[model samples]
Target chain A: MSERPPVPVITPGALARRRLHVMFALDCSGSMRGDRIASLNYAMRSALPELLSVAEDNPEVQVMVQVMRFDTVARWHIDEPTPIEEMEWIDLDAGGETAMGSALAQIGEALDSAEAGPRQLPPVIVLASDGYPTDDIDAGLEQFFSSAAATAATRIAIAIGSNTDLDTLERFMNSPEARLKPLRANNAPDLVKSIKWATTAPVKATSSPTNAPDVASQLALNAEQLEAPSSEVVW
Target chain B: MSWRAGGATAIGASHIRNKRPNQDAFYASPTQQSDPRFMICVADGHGSDAYYRSDIGARLAVEAFIEAISWNLDSPEQINSLPQDIVQIWRRLVKQDIGRNPLPPGFERAPGRASDRDIFEPYGSTLVGVAASEQICIVVQIGDGDLLLGYEDGTINRPLAADTGLHGEQTYSLCLDDAPQRVKYKAIKRTETWPDFVLTSTDGVSKAFVDDAAFVDVVRHYRELVRSGEDLQATINALPDWLRQVSDNGSGDDATLCLASRRYKIQDQ
Candidate 1:
């Protein structure tokens, strides 16, 4: 008989299968003041924990999140992502010029150092805005969407008000297939729903939806029917 | 009877013997004799996607690591050099090797795939590995995985250290699916007077042993078990169950570990 010791049998355990990291870029510009900011605040307070549930017991499956609030200049309310349990309600003040450009720039910068895990999904950036941008929208969008890095990143957008420029917001989403939502209500429910969808969307490493717009309808969309063909965007 | 060279190695390894949809790939070799040189490499492919011929990707990674070191094994000095643009070169080589395998049936091959990134599409897997000698230790990873070093004193340390920060933002890991630019690396000079053990694993094992102290304890115990004259195969046999018990049945990604001790015989040196 062989004298070598016997090898042990390892029964596989339930691992935290799905791991994701999501970032939210909120438009705290003057147009987002009053009801808009309030709705966003309420939505965030209710949504962050639910998003954390995606990780389950897998402490390794962390969602390192960051929030950038923009007016004339983008201010990082939560520059680094805190654990969902540790996250707090961010009270945004709306009075500065719309610096959506600066906000996009910051979003790109923050994702630069982001890391991935075994099943790391692409970093998800959700941009929520209410009114038309007072800043150069094209330049801001370009800054956020131009590079291969930004294009490689997953971007989703939610148009918050009737005055919310759908065309401009479309540009804010980096992926042609970026998920988009039109929020008709300045209420708490709509805010929370939009936040939930943005954080939970799968951004798996291999089959990252480069054109997320096609997948947008899979997420929450506004009541009004969109005239834009979702298939048009690819990058 | 005296301890003989190559008589045994303390490296501990265990995996479910039965092939389950996804297979784990690993390679370990004791390259240096005098300095007790050794290397452990591992990779885990996502099991869900068809594009995840990650098993092949993982196998390629370990093979490439072995081949790279083997090509330069004579020059012990080169391991610490971390050669200029070595990271980039290593990345390119991995991409090429991973792409060399024929695409599974129903997958189309893109002709004249000009770039490393382009030809190596639909490929993803986490890679973590270590190359060590008596005097030096080097670790590198791109995506998520863990590297552990157990010293002779029973003291254990994780090279990436622990992310104890509020949100643990500083922690980094490899993702098979990240852009080549996003791939990161970590390396350090080895400094230990006694025999040490090194292990590299996919997230499967990391998840099983999430708590550093708890994981280190298991590793320490297993090392002792093997050193006590238990067959290495016995220790390997026990790993999966122990991991399941330790993880309390968390997520089940393919788990793997390559354990090797620094003690070698005078002849092998």
Candidate 2:
């Protein structure tokens, strides 16, 4: 029940969407050369469908994935940010000493450069490591977290073995915000579970509200209650 | 001096799948209202486990807006107190509702809730409100939503400043402390000239777009749509479906759009 006016104007045909970036920093140190790296590769492949499903369910943000590997040095694994569906994964080669700091710096630099606008969701970073860093972690972290994008990112870590340096991981995952300690995985099966969890949770949070003020904290709380993985130390 | 106005609120796609209620609420006075001023409001409740009561909170925010505008509709100088009045009235309404339905025994709060004692957290919401007469137009915003003033010219003006906190990643809310102090207020009273129309929408509508200019251009297109339509009612009727599509593929959050126009004349059927 309103007044008469002019003819209707056609709107643009396509819907515009925001982007949500998810990155993985895998530890390819010498300790992970055998069963550990193999489990990681398998776990990542298994996790993709679940992540893709979650991303597809919420079309609001274009879910993109980036990957990096670290041993004596860190380098790009995926090379460029790719949509979750198109994010192809290859088995990572394990080598040399842990360069956890170098890995953080590499991913950090990428996020800093790809920096999100008001419409974009802050990037989510998942760090998986099996041992202490052989590189300068403090300097690397400083370089990585210098940007606002890195500052606001959701950071998660996977402790791949009994020898994981919790202190270093904790530094990367600044406390209070990174509510969950590094997800502990002492064996290959546990490693797979940790990787699956690390990949999917934050990606899902990027698209869905989950009815919480802080999805990261909620994820941390849930991760804590997960049933313990196998007790056998197979890593 | 008559006005033409309509508004719509649609449940978001994500909310539908999650079984969450539509957290968006709105009010647009009809052209035939007896009140001299045409008032419009769009409110978005912070819906999550923490804001369990936000749907009600959003409803109350709209009611509070109407209540606040009623007092200051004619007096532009008294506009400074509008935000305070809205907060005062909304909290009172929320308290009354709380007394009627107290938090159940052993009812756990959302884990990420800001503070355990901050009972208002369950009803936090952001709102943009406008009360316009032929001569005076008043706009007030408390959080993350769009408020644009369209002119007879092709240009558009955003009454509120840029807010980095859109789509509720973080935002100010009526339920938060010192809310009135955070409110961004603007009043325009020009007998010779006024905005041709005023447009406001929750962030969900904008989230479906690439950027602010694109979203604003869409608002301009809606105005053109109304101008081109055989009747403004047709355009109004089309909003819900359009918003549904935006939410389905864009923000996946509740969407609401409110428009009030003095420039467009509605021919009575």
Candidate 3:
């Protein structure tokens, strides 16, 4: 009888996987208190599974998530880029002013390769806000875009509720060439769908083996298709 | 002079949920026996919904690569232009496949379908391969993956560096509009005593390692196995199981490995 081939010993380095950082900057202002904040929390928690699915499909690319909440002050709810499967979402309560500028500044700082891991995919940044900024939006955006990593990041903005400042959100998108408009969510269902789309679509699209067109261009196309009258959710 | 070649691919653990076919594909020409000339190609399909037919695309890519090299074997100019030739043939095959198998009902068209250029989006995949003759070997790659040459002196090195990008998963694919420009090509001349073996694999294997050095060590380990003379058939047969463990514990993505080795006879034997 032939002897069986020896079982190959697995090495420690054999388990290493590449990472994709995904950051969420949420507006937890006074205006977002009650149902709005509740919906945001629910939407984010629900989006976790879909995000994990993306990570599973693209095993070479591990999805690491970071979340920042901004009210009168901006701070990281989850500071480090934690693997999506291992990450736990803590519900954020709403109060205070919309210091979105400060949040953007913080996001910019985190975008630094030194701060984030040097070896990671271009990050996916999703900003969901229900109100305008109470601070210098330009100053924050400038600081954020200064980092080449941040500039290359796929940026998506969600205008939650009717009071959102679309102009500011549009500028945050930073893709004038793609002409992608900010996603709008008028109700709980709309907010959930928009959040789901914002979180998963870019990760899925950008992770393709092909030279995926810019996320902004892809989003613009999605927006057009979703905006059609027959579509379920109007973005 | 003859060669021993074998290639295999395993589905990622993550794909089991949907029962999605293995998105990675590989082909080794002259499968029947050792040949002085042979070609080996491996392709990884884009795992996005937009790339619905990427599995087929990957298979077509390897087939096209083999066909291109086979047709241009005797022509130095055509061999040098393998990158361009492969893409041309690949695009033609993709179009033909699309014509034969129309999109399934209610398939979502990729965004920005204004022209024929967008039509190839569904069949997006990355190609990395090599064609070798008795005297020369050519390596060509369009996207992410590793191609390494193992020398008889126990040194192993990647012929073409893995394309690094801010996004780890993003890579140049054959479906890209600028694929012709993005494809990387390298030609290696075989010496009397060097590069005893060649291995081509998708990112799944390398990404499983902590770093490039660690990956090189794994390749070296394989090189030792091939050189161990413990029965080539056994080594080849055990590769898929070994790769399955690599993916299960590491990247959990589809993994593929194609190997080619130069055989030397022992005068005493």
RMSD of each: 10.4, 3.4, 4.4
Best by DockQ: 2
Interface DockQ of each model:
0.09, 0.42, 0.33
Native contacts, share recovered per candidate: 0.10, 0.36, 0.30
Q: Is candidate 2 or candidate 3 better by DockQ?
A: 2
User: Could you tell me every candidate's TM-score relative to the true structure?
Assistant: 0.52, 0.88, 0.82
Candidate 1 lDDT over B1-269, as tens digits, reads 11111111111122222132343467666433324566677765434333245556556556655665443444555654333233344456655754576555544443443443333433445556776554555665554567776766777777664322111111221221233433343444444344356667665565544344445565676566545555444455555555554333433445666666544223322
Candidate 2 per-residue lDDT over residues A102-207, each given as its tens digit: 7887777787678466667767888998888999999999988886677777788888878888998888778575577888888878877877877777777666
**Which stretches in model 3 have alpha-carbon errors above 4 Å?**
A1-8, A17-21, A33-35, A41-64, A80-96, A111-123, A146-154, A175-180, A196-235, B29-33, B103-114, B161-168, B190-194, B264-269
Off by over 4 Å in 1: A1-155, A160-162, A165-200, A203-235, B1-24, B29-37, B46-51, B80-114, B131-143, B158-194, B208-213, B227-231, B244-248, B262-269
Candidate 1 yields a Cα-based lDDT of 0.52
Question: What do the candidate models score in CA lDDT, each in turn?
Answer: 0.52, 0.77, 0.76
Candidate 2 vs 3: which has more lDDT? 2
lDDT of 2 at B83: 77
- Residue B30 lDDT, candidate 2, scale 0-100: 74
Worst 10 residues of 2 chain B by lDDT: B108-117
Order the candidate numbers by lDDT, best to worst. 2, 3, 1
Which residue runs does candidate 2 get wrong by more than 4 Å?
A1-14, A175-180, A209-213, A227-235, B31-35, B108-117, B164-168, B191-193, B227-230
Candidate with top lDDT is 2
Residues B1-269 of candidate 2 have per-residue lDDT tens digits of 65677888889988888798998899999744323468889999885566778889889999998888877776667888887888889989888888899976644354455553366767878889888775677888887888987777766789778754323265777866767777787778875457767888988888777676677777887666654434566667778887787777678889999987764555663
Q: lDDT of model 2 at residue B99? A: 88
